[model samples]
Every structure is written in structure tokens, then in C-alpha cells.
Target: MSDTSPFDPVGHESLADAVVEQIETMIVDGILKEGHKLPSERDLAEAMGVSRPKLREALQILESRDLVTVRHGEGSFIAPLSGRAMSPALLALYARHGRAFYDYLEYRREQECFAARTAALRATQSDKDRLRDIIDEMQKAWEEDDAEASQEADLRLHVAVVDASQNTTLIHMMASVYDLTRQGVFYNRRFLRTMDGTGEKLLQQHKDIVATILAGDPDAAEQAARAHLDFVEESFRLGEEQKARETRAAKRRKLSGQASR
Candidate 1:
């Protein structure tokens, strides 16, 4: 009887499977972020050390899995995974309700605290450098009194911390959350920026978070994240209250004038 094993040695199919895994891992790690276009098939195959046929097979599989979108002539691109994670209906609901703002903050507080703690443990040297650069950007924005730039940097800092956590799930989920924040679906980012002394305080809070993470102090990083969120919640409350009072005062003045007329 022949002594050959029943299983075949790993072959073209296996090579294709490996290519799929490599691309998937890159996507999950955010190395190939959403909507990033893939290189030409020949270039990619050469870079990946695989034959063009195997790369094509892997690309086909990824396209079917909704992880990639292929254009007939333009080449393949990473699908917008983060955007798909949150439904339009849910986004609209959050936008329609004031209560959702605080709820979002509460959710973010927990998420950010966990992210900061994990980042402290997992952050690479490159991650630390990115955080430092973002802090510097925030400082520049603050000095220039540029609320929009400051707000953008604020979100970028939080996103960078989450990225440093090296947790794929958290990174994707928070991407959607931050997208909502950018769209002002929960609360106006400007409100937090416009409060008295808030820009300075926020810049410092971000710096402290980065410092703790860089120091590899998980406890301090978590606490700093929580404290920062607490301040943001309080600032939002105060801003809302002040707006309500102003609206009421305006209504009263309008009524008084009409009655006098």
C-alpha cells in the first residue's frame, strides 16, 4: 500500500488564503484605513511576495466579504467599515434628542477610560510620538484661538489614544463615535471650545493623558481620561443651561414689548 498521506501539501489555495489573512490583518490593525485605495495588482502581488493569480483570488474573497470594494478600472479600495458600523437611523435619533448627548458622553467616558488604560500598556514608540504631535497641534490651535482646529485636534487626540490601545474592536467602534461627534450629532464641539478658559484646560487635560500614557501608567491614564470627560460633561451642562436661560429671557422680553404695544 502506498504510504502517501491523505492530505495534500499546502498549494495555490493556501497561498491565496495567506494573502487574504495578510490583507485582513492590515485592515484590522488600521494600517490600511477605510477608503484607502489598494495598489495596482501587479505592484501589490510583488510587494506581498505572491503571484498575481493568488493576489487576485485573495482580492476577490475580500471583495465578497465586503471588506473591499473593487472598481472595474480604478482598482480596489478598503470599504468604509466604520461608517457602516453605525446606522443612519441611529445617527438621526441621536441627533434629534438632547438626552442623547449626555448618554453619548457617558458611553465615551467608559470607552475612553478603557482605551487610555490599554494604551498605557500597549502603545508603541510611534504611538507616543503621534500623541505628542497632536498635543503640540492642540497647543498651537489654542494659542491662535482657532476653535475649529482645536476641536479637530481634540478628536484626533482621543482617536490616537484609542489607536494606541491596539484593540481592533475599540478602534473601529470609536471611529464611528467620533464621526458622529464631528458631525455634531450629539453636541456641538464648539460649545466645549467656547467656554471660558476651556481651550486651555482642554489642552492641558489632553497633555496629561498623553503624559500618563507615555509613562506607561495605566491607572493615571484611566483617571485622567475620566476627569477630562467629567469636565466636558459639566461644560456641556452649563452651556445648555445658559442657552435655555437666554431663550427664556428673550421670550419674556418679546411678550413684554407686545403687551406694551
Candidate 2:
């Protein structure tokens, strides 16, 4: 019988992730070095026994993660690691989706905390105003009792803070950083069952963050961001524990049913 475990290439993960893992291993094992040119697209596809499109997709993933540098005319080269540029997207990739939900959230919170600290050091007056506008939007959404609106405003608020450092590259790099955090924290925040005054509480905290930014102190902004992340981390922790317990119960029930049969 053929093996059908999720660890198989055609199972749990995308083909792209599987191919990326294979290439990453070669690099890590010293088979590929910095500035080393990888095989031509066709050659790589032949070697991996995958289609050209699948191989390209895997290379794109590697490019995004800074593991490989694709030069338009010069082909793909092993990327340098002189300066590590971390983001929530990288964290999400590391987390491996729902199976690693809580683990991913923890990593994202750390990155957000670091960005917040840097924002305090570099935010400008315009950045401060942008933060205020986001908070005001949240407050209005809360008064209207609109969860979607409130959550969206909450998302923009966090992203805007990271964008405030005026580093266009950083801004672009973190474009999708909050995606995992959104699924982790906002699901609970938006749910009526798990949420109690979460929208209002977040509004209040956002207001405080705006005030800190307006005061032109990065230290205060950093503290406010940390405080907010703390609440978010706690929320995910409880959710994680609940999920773990349920998973074990499901497994036991499955075993019991099999034994009875």
C-alpha cells in the first residue's frame, strides 16, 4: 500500500512549501553557499521531478523569505544573511498554520513589540496624526457597535503604527505581518461567545497609544504597544489550552470507537 500520511508532498502542505524545504536543506547542509548560482529553472524542475511552474513557485517563496536572490538577467543566487529582516509573514511561515496557531501568535507578538519600540524612536508628527485617526475610527465603530468595522479599524491601527517609522522597505516587508495575528486574536475579539467588551477595551487602549505617539515619545509608544500585546497574548494562551484539551478528547474518542468495533 502507498503511504498517505500528511508528511507526504501531496498532503497537508502546499507543493511549494515542500519544494522550498528541499532546497533549504541543501543550502543549510553547505551544498549551496552565498552567491552560488542555482540550477536553471528547467534543470531544477527536472532534478526535483516537478513541473516548471511548481518549481518557480517554490523559488518565489524562497525569494520572499530572503533565502534566495533572483536576479532578472543573472539568474538566482544564494541570498546573504548579513542583516536579518524579520516580519509577521516570516513568523506565519514558521508557525505552519492552525496546527501552530498559538506558537505563531507568540512569535508575531514579539515582532510587533519590536516594531512598536522602533516606531517610538522614529515616528513623526504625521505618523502621530495617522495613529489618532485610526483610534478615532475605532471609537466611532465601537459606538456604532459594528464588530467588522471595529476589527478592521483595529487592524489598520496596528499596521499604521508599524508603518510610522517611515522606512518604506519595512512598511512593504510587513505588509502581511498581521495576518496570523488577526486570525489568532481577532477571531476571539470578534466572536460574541469569547468576547466581552473587547472592542471597547481596545478602543480605550488605542486612544492611549495615540496620546503617547502625539506626545512624541517612542518609549511611551513602545510601552503602550507592549501592554496591548500582553492582553492579546493572554487571550491566545487560553484559546490554545482549550484547543489542546479538545484535541486530546477527540483522539481518545476515536480510539474508543475503534476498540469497540
Candidate 3:
């Protein structure tokens, strides 16, 4: 009988969420407070009924929102009111459905807007040439109707702008979490479809952005970036809203059928 199992069994599909909730509740209930240092990673992993990876994901979410902070060579600590930071969980939740799409897009727009502004001031001529090449690649890919490749090219162009800043910190910030932003751009996969000649419009926008960067005109570069982002943001927001409405209507009809039965 090998010492008779000392514990009972528990079952839940999303154990990670449950663990996160428990820790969150403890913090809310005053068991844990802001600025309080948490146990070492090893200790917390042992204390929680979760794997290190799961715990790390939870901690990453909190860190993104500034709920926690991990200093170099030090353990994690609860963060003070550090304002809002971009959390992975938030991005995933937003990307899950249409309603949350705009939120994530707006967040991305703000980040990119700043990146463009900085790059305008800091980008070198070589950086300008690099960005133009990426845009040209996007045009070629789109012409070939290679939707996936086109999208990648588009992202590369934007990421190139951020990279042109030659600022690793900024590049790292964008690279760290860009999946949801990228997905939201093609939200509902609509980007794969023909743009009905919107391609030229988009191309001009890119040209304007690059021209400003080359001319060292920070104001124009920032505005061009914002304008381009605004168009994409609006398209995503409208499409997402429409999808959510359709989903809700479908749910209602399903419920009505069950009730009739």
C-alpha cells in the first residue's frame, strides 16, 4: 500500500487560470500587498500547484501590466501603481474575439506611432533605403497574390522602421510581443483578400512615410505613420464589431431552438 496516498485528487481543465486567480485573490485580500517581494522563483513554483512555465506565463502577464517587476539579478516584486503596461494575456484575450480587437490595435498604434516618431529623428540614410526596399517587397508579394508573404513583408517594413532607430531597447520592446498586433491587422483573415485597388493607397502612404524619414522631417514622418495606422485601425474595429454582432445573433437563434425543443 505504499504509504496510502496522502492527498486527494483535483480536476480542472485550466489549472493555470485557477492558480492565477488564487494569487490575485491573495493580493486583493491583503494577504499580499504592493511592493512586497514574492518568494524566489524556485520557492513560488514549489508553492503553487503549477509548473515553472505556467507560473512564468502568469508572472509575465502581471509584469506586462506592471503588477510585478523583475529586476536584473533579483527576484520578482509586486509593482506599485506603475500605470498600464502591455500584458500578453490582454493581447491574447483581445485577439480571441472581435470586441477585443480594437483595444489591442489601439495599443499597437500607440507603440508604433512612437516608434515612427523616434525613427524619423534617429534613422540613418541606410535605414531609409532599407525601409523602402521592404515596402517594394510588399508590393511585389501583393502583386503575386502571396497573401501570407505580403503580410510578412508589411510587418517587416514596419519592424524595419523600428529597427532603423538602431535602438535595441525599442526593437526588443516591439519584438517581445507583436503577434497579436500582427494577427489583428489580418483579423478575420480579411487581409488575404484583394484590396480593390486600396493597394496603391497603401503604397503611397508608405512612400510618404519613407520620404519624411529621408528628409529628416520628424513632424511629417510622425503624421504619415499615424495616418496609415489610423486607416488599418478603423478597418479592424468595424470588421470586428460586425463579426461580434453576427456571433451574438447566431447564439440567440441557437438558444431559441433549444428552448422550443
Candidate 4:
């Protein structure tokens, strides 16, 4: 996406507002993508046929809305629209409540299943290649015991699957919760993998998902994704159960020590 073509001069009564709307329309339409740099003040003003003062007002409006970020000396650039709005709030929820994390997984399960099915049906050759590359990276990271890298690769693979879905709305929706997903799923992956045989099983599951998608088997892709997430959810439950048991044992030990004293 790029800056939109020039429009007629802002001769309307609400000139600044009209200019703001024009720029907003360009951004909302994806003509100016996240992180894309805007034209210089003079260039933009000339292009839009608006006075420099009017362009500044429009820029200020965009900045206020966080659609643009202005740096000292440097020009304005498109701001990241997804995380700015939701990340902090979602992070607070995850931090405050354990169950919020599981709720996220439930949401992810539904979204990923749909993404996997759609990807199987629509993935381009390039998307398949990227998935294969990420899988290879996962394999290398796992073999080298690079847990962080492996988790990153795992997340990337899932994100790539969603990207292959070719659904813009779906993409945006997933992107909105991506930070929560990263924190909940990727951050906890190491602990889950520590369970005996769990890491190997997960690796096989990832392979199955990619293979099914490559084979253009939407049903199998969806099943593979569901099966993988089912394993993850069960692991989460078992981990919580173990923690409860450990807490109970600690309490009992404390009580025994107190009685002996």
C-alpha cells in the first residue's frame, strides 16, 4: 500500500476536517500500511492541494488517533494499528487471572481450526514454502535445545497458516490478539514440552498439520490443528492439577512439622 493519488484541492468549508478524512480513508483502505512513511510536508501538501497549515492540522488529527507517529526531525510514519489498542488491556487480563489464559486458548482453537482449513484450501506455493521453512527452523531449534527459538518458530508457523487463509478480516482479528497468543502459548510452550514425550508429540503434530495442508486436505488440516490444541489444553489442565497436589503436600508437611514441634 502507498500514499493515495492526489485529490482536488480542499476548497470545502471544513478544509482541515476534509483533509483529515481523506488521509484517514487512505489509511483505512490500506493504501498507507503500518510503518509506511508519509510524504514530506511540502510534497504532501502539494499533492493533496491543501495548504501546509491545513496538512499540519490533518497530521495532528491522525497523530491524536495514533494512525501516525511523528518523530523529531524524522517524518511521520504509519503507526501499528493492532497492538496499540488492545495489547496492554489483554496483558493486564492475562496477568490478573490464570483462567484468562485458557480462555485465550479456547478462542485460538476456534480461530486456528478455521485458519488451518482455509489455508489447506487456499495456501499459495509461497505460503507452503514459508511453512516448510519455519518447520525446519523448529526442527533445528528443538534438536539444539533452543527452546526460545523453537517457540518463536512454532508461533511463526501458526501465524503463517493464518496468513495463508486469504481472509483480510480473519487476519486482522487474529492479529489483534496476537500478543496474547504469544504470551500465553509461546511463553508456556517450554513448560508444556518438558512433560515426557510431549515435545516429540508436538513436533509430530506440527508436521502433520503442514503435510495435510500441503496435500490440500482441508478436513485433515482442521483435524490436525484440533488434535494438537487438544493436547496442549490437556497438558495445561494436568499441569494445574500437579500444582494443586504439590500445594496440598506442602501444607501437610507444614502441619506435621508443627505437631512435632
Q: Which is the leading candidate under TM-score?
A: 1
TM-score of each: 0.86, 0.52, 0.54, 0.72
- Candidate 1 wrong stretches, greater than 4 Å: 1-14, 82-86
Candidate 4 on 1-261: residue-level lDDT in tens?
125544545666787898888877766544455777888988888876778898899889989998889886999898887654245765676677778667777888999999999999999998899999999998998888888898889888887898888776676677666656575632478877976354778888999999999999999999999999898888878888999999999999999999999
- Candidate 2: tens digits of C-alpha lDDT, residues 1-261: 124211223323567777898778766533454567887877666555677788789889999999999999888998864333345575556555554555545665666666677777777776778887888888888888887788788878878877766555455445544554455523445642254444666677778766776776767777787787677667666777888999999999999999999
Worst 10 residues of 2 by lDDT: 1-10
Where in model 3 is the C-alpha error above 4 Å?
Answer: 1-92, 182-189, 192-198, 244-261
Clash-forming residue pairs, model 2: 120-218
- Please write out the lDDT profile of model 3 over residues 87-170, one tens digit for every residue: 667655554655565565676677777777888888877688888788788778767767677667777777778776666656
Question: Over the full model, what C-alpha lDDT does candidate 3 score relative to the true structure?
Answer: 0.67
lDDT, candidate 4, equals 0.81
Off by over 4 Å in 2: 1-99, 179-188, 242-261
Estimate every model's Cα lDDT from 0 to 1. 0.86, 0.68, 0.67, 0.81
Output the TM-score of candidate 1. Answer: 0.86
* Cα lDDT, model 4, residue 19: 82
